[model samples]
Target: MGSGISKARRGLLYISYNGKVQKFMFDRKATSRDIQEQLAISCGLTRLSNVILKCRGDVIAISPSMPNNTPQEPYTLEQAGYNVSANDIIASTVKEIGKQFRQAFMVEETKREVYNRVASIESRVEKDGKRLMEMEKYKLDLVELRDAIYNKQTNTLDYNRLRPAITLPNHFYCPSTEQESLISMARDIPAYNKYVLTNETKEALKTPQFDVWQWEPNEMLILLEEMYFELGLVDELDIHPATLKRFLLRVQENYRNNPFHNFRHCFCVTQMMYVLIHGCRLQEVLSKRDICVLLTACICHDLDHPGFNNTYQINSRSELAVRYNDMSPLENHHCAVSFKILSSPECNIFANLTPEEFKEVRGDMIILILATDMARHAEILDAFKQKLDNFDYSSEDHLNTLKMILIKACDISNECRPIQVSEGWVECLMEEYFHQSDQEKKECLPVAPFMDRDRVTKPTAQIGFIKYVLLPLFEALNKLYPEVEFIALESLKQALNHYERMKDFDENKKKLFAGPVMSKSGRDWYSEKQMVDEGGQ
Candidate 1:
């Protein structure tokens, strides 16, 4: 190491690429080239040709071939106009990278999906072309026969003729082999269990880990199928694993490429919901139907969120708010869009269930999904609090109240996870908040508090949120389910303490940045103190 070169900051370096976040850290003596090589590896890029490093809209890439393993001259953090702190976001502008990559990939994937779907539909048309006419004839003949028989013999119409009143005897609307091949992918379940489930480095079930960066949307179907298998819900619920995979693929496809509210967030929330369910043994309290709905709702709770809050929707007079009459518009949209996906022939994972069962599941799913509305937070919180006021474990309403509370907790449980995970989600949320703020500014609407990135907030705001919002919610939960919330509450307390310290540091930093400090000789109080002090050396 040269005298001029210094050690780089050793902390978590989160690499966001193609809608996937990979966690890594640079070596202390890492040069610019080292960073490039590490970044390439961390982002799962095969070659460095396409990789571009940007900071605040400025390109940082200097050469076509980035440094391999060769050690090079060290670059100063100061030279790069950055600070090497204990907890630093080295790639501060990585959100833009994620956004750009997601847009590009989404476009390409959308084209592929559209092409496949069109081809499948065409193939179906070609195959069902004959049956289509037959179905039409059958429908026409039945209508005509029924009309003539009823007209001729009024009440004495022969029931024998109408015995086989089948409208399209075959399910022609069902998915063809081509469509099924597109929708479903056979998974190596044993590999998933061995690699993801059994691995020590992977996050343990119900045991929160520092890694909260969502698994890539590309890997969602496999992970979801494995999740379904791990919970034994496939056999219990009588859902074929292939149907579940199809359902998941459709759901994931529909999720918009928003920074925070994408399919990755859905997986994250579903992961949290899994922890809550098994950790609290809510399954023992609630029926399998309720449990299934709870988990499923977590998956579909934020489908197609447009990266705007309810207030923005109402103020902008968005169609969603208008359609829902300003009553949990996003929640309603999520439920409706999700159920519509489920209703598709290829994606109907719940098709095996009876009509009553399906209805109950959908109804419960809607209730649970709608419960994620922040406006209903206070209402749900108060209602649950009232339940806590008069505790009853056996009551069905009480159980549902608890379910609502758990789902709400899981929805925002990003903070309840390990600190690294917590920080990752906070960054994600802040990015989303800043985007909303930018939109609000463009629309001439009042920017929401703590949303605008220009007006920086101290850790005080986070501390307040954890204390005021999450603390009470988790506390109430902990009272009912003792050990279930201990880990989460402790993490919250730790975060609170951290923010409190950061608040003091921010105050001091503000003082330094505010103005020039007054010298002792410049102050009249100095002379007064000297005169008051006896035997001052």
Candidate 2:
């Protein structure tokens, strides 16, 4: 027979040498000499003959009288009473082979004991390894949960506050309350008039024609505070003017410098809300608390916007989406940041409000902010339309619906501005839209048809949006307040006419250059736009 056997004839054996145990496979019929030679080569030993192989702490011996079992005979492992199937350790020591023989009665006991012990040890080791891996994975998960849900340093979830406090604007430093009070006192003087707006600016701000593009950031900040004062919110809400200034400053600080959804868009929306309140005479009709809620919601509606819409958040499975479970993630974030600012003692403009009042305001603000999500446009418009026919201002439900419609109207009211002003906003919106589309292309996500700059022209972009979204919303609001038709609806209609003319010009230009016509696919584009807009922000 050959010294080596096929895999099927090989059985496992454990070997203990140099204080370490290792597994080895041996032929089932391998003799002591064959094993000794193989081990010597495998273990890098220079000599093999002098090695003593022990089973169960005694030397393996063959009786001299046994056939082929003389003291020098090469006996198979089974002849020495070792079961290759048991995979028992063959303990070897580097010494002369001993002449001792284990009694016959002990052989069976030793084989069974070795098998049980080896099997037990291996089973335990495998189970322990798996347990260790599981425990390690669990530890990592706990640490992640702890970090995400709690502040490690504070060891508490500071749910009310956002970390790394809002940055103070230029020309302002972190001032002590004493200093702030003194500044407020000085500002109360008529001579300290730098923050005051011109009569023309104030009057202009009261109308829809107020041009946001004409103001600088600092000027806009002052305008916002002045608007709050002009609305009597500062007095009715018991807002400390100094505290209000700080809050507005922090609000400005939080808005990112995106192409469109930055501080300017925020101011424009709030200004439009102001225009709506006055244009519709809502100040006389709506409660003071309701007007306060409307204005505050408009101010903080798009706080800290990252410029990407909800569709991207959901599609990309972004952190914000995961944080809010993909339900109006941006709107939820806006509310969180808004309240985060409010939670700060220095910026808590609503501090004078009772707990119940604060809760009511917070809830209303959340509703208004979330209503700005374009996906809810049709739902909110329909609900408002339903209420307009009954039009009971005394009904809490009807009043709340009007507040929602007002904020929604103001949020997208750029189209209601004068043509020159509205055109500038369209450019800004286009820039932001194109940026998002470009990112979608880079990330291999579906780009919104209207946002794809290559597929859409300026006129095409605004035309469908005006026809489908803006006119319907404002026209509904006009039903409740006929005065709004002249104030805002006229501007919207003029803007629509201007874009229509521009669309014709664009088509003519395309015809002159032999460019592909978009009118052929106009219906498809508008349909896809509505679907995506509903699914998107």
Candidate 3:
């Protein structure tokens, strides 16, 4: 019964042995001394102990201390515990079996752990990459949606292509991808571009019978741009540009009074505010967020104004004045309407603003709009002059002073613009005042100066107004804004010239001058210091 066996090469220990005639298995873990004494004669060479064990079955027999050397007999073993025939002796003399098995097992376990960890990391990276791609796709989709809405092509939206819903960890859920995309897209589009482009076309189509010609889209757009730009100036003012577009859309849809206080008026005011912020250097004093609020106030300052001045409300005990106890009734109404629009989720351009920012916006807007009331004009002018008198042009506080001046300037900005523009506004105002006068007389009520439709020499009164009222106001504004003085002077000079050119003309001119003088005692009322005292009170 000869059998083969493998041995531990490094340890020089016998792994197994074979036996036919007889053979002895050497311990693989045996020390050098043991191998030299016990196994050297049988093993042949000291270093060849492992080879001798592997070739155990080939030899015939082992003779102790034979001359020179002798071939070893194959060694075989019988099982000590299980009674099973053994081909070779196990290499257990040095406990080698236990050590080798433990080493192999640990190596396999380590390799497996490393492989699993690598797989997990790769999986996580793949998942995150996919999430990022999805988010980017959503953003692009929103931009497309905004374009479609501006073009009024919402019907063309491919709703089916949008995701059902996307929820953020913050609990904000965009119900449909299409909706989210549209709103987001609107954010980047300039709200007033179309208005600016179309203003001339609208104005060109106007006729006296249908005074809609004065409604210039471009002018309106300019106004909106100014307001939006100002709002963008405040710190942490998180107003979305989309909110402003929505607000403008609402104004266009609901308020269409033909001339002054219409959409065009809002537009102009908005642009005027912008000019104040940048050209007038108010940006240094007001925060970007305050600018937005100011712009909003400008846009909505005369909203739903009904084309009548404060005198109409006071004289009629109008519902608006009565409701607000005649305390800046029109101003209060305009501010309330603006805020009401802002309260809508769709109109909350400043939705991301802090609570404090929102409060400041509301406060600034109210103050500015209320200041626009003509009754407050004198007071505003007086305060402005006083501030200028004590001007500290070099102080850091110059910005604040500039803001106050700009607001007041914007409130009466029409008086300081081109003569033609100012005259156009005055004409519109006079017409509305006369219309109201007609209504008053029809209702059997007494009417005030410009409000009374039936009167003599209305045109001459208007010319006198240019001399006493308009010219004085312009002179004051010129004193404050030397750069704008040319416009104010030109406007007053033109009005005066026009009056003089026609003051002595014939029959047709007399017909044109038939109505009562549109002038009143308070035409220069805005320039008095008394007005400022009343305003402060």
RMSD of each candidate? Answer: 30.6, 32.8, 29.1
Model 3 earns a TM-score of 0.51
Tens digits of lDDT, candidate 3, 1-537: 522434442222232333333334444454544543455445333422322222334432222222222334223322223221232344353467788889999999999999999999997898789789989999997786655445334556555433211111111112232322212223233533454435544333221111223556644554454445434542346545566567675555434354455666565555555554544455565556656666666667776566556666767787677777988887887776666666778877767778886786677677777777767666655665666666665663443444544555555555444555555766665666666677677777778765565662445666766666556554665565674444346655765676566666744664444422333256445334444666733
How many residue pairs clash in each candidate at the backbone level?
A: 0, 1, 32
Candidate 2's C-alpha runs over 4 A off are 1-193, 515-537
Top candidate (lDDT): 2
User: Who is ahead in lDDT, 1 or 3?
Assistant: 1
How does each model score on TM-score?
0.61, 0.61, 0.51
Which tens-of-lDDT digit does each residue in 374-419 have in candidate 1?
8888888888888886778788788778888888888888777777
How far in Å is the alpha carbon of 339 misplaced in model 3? 0.5
**Stretches of candidate 3 exceeding 4 Å from the true structure:** 1-215, 226-236, 256-259, 276-278, 392-408, 415-423, 456-474, 504-537
How well does candidate 2 score on lDDT at residue 393? Answer: 76
Among all windows of ten consecutive residues in candidate 2, which has the lowest summed lDDT? Answer: 165-174
Worst 10 contiguous positions by lDDT, candidate 1? 165-174
- Using TM-score as the yardstick, the better of models 1 and 3 is 1
What value does the lDDT take at residue 65 in candidate 1?
36
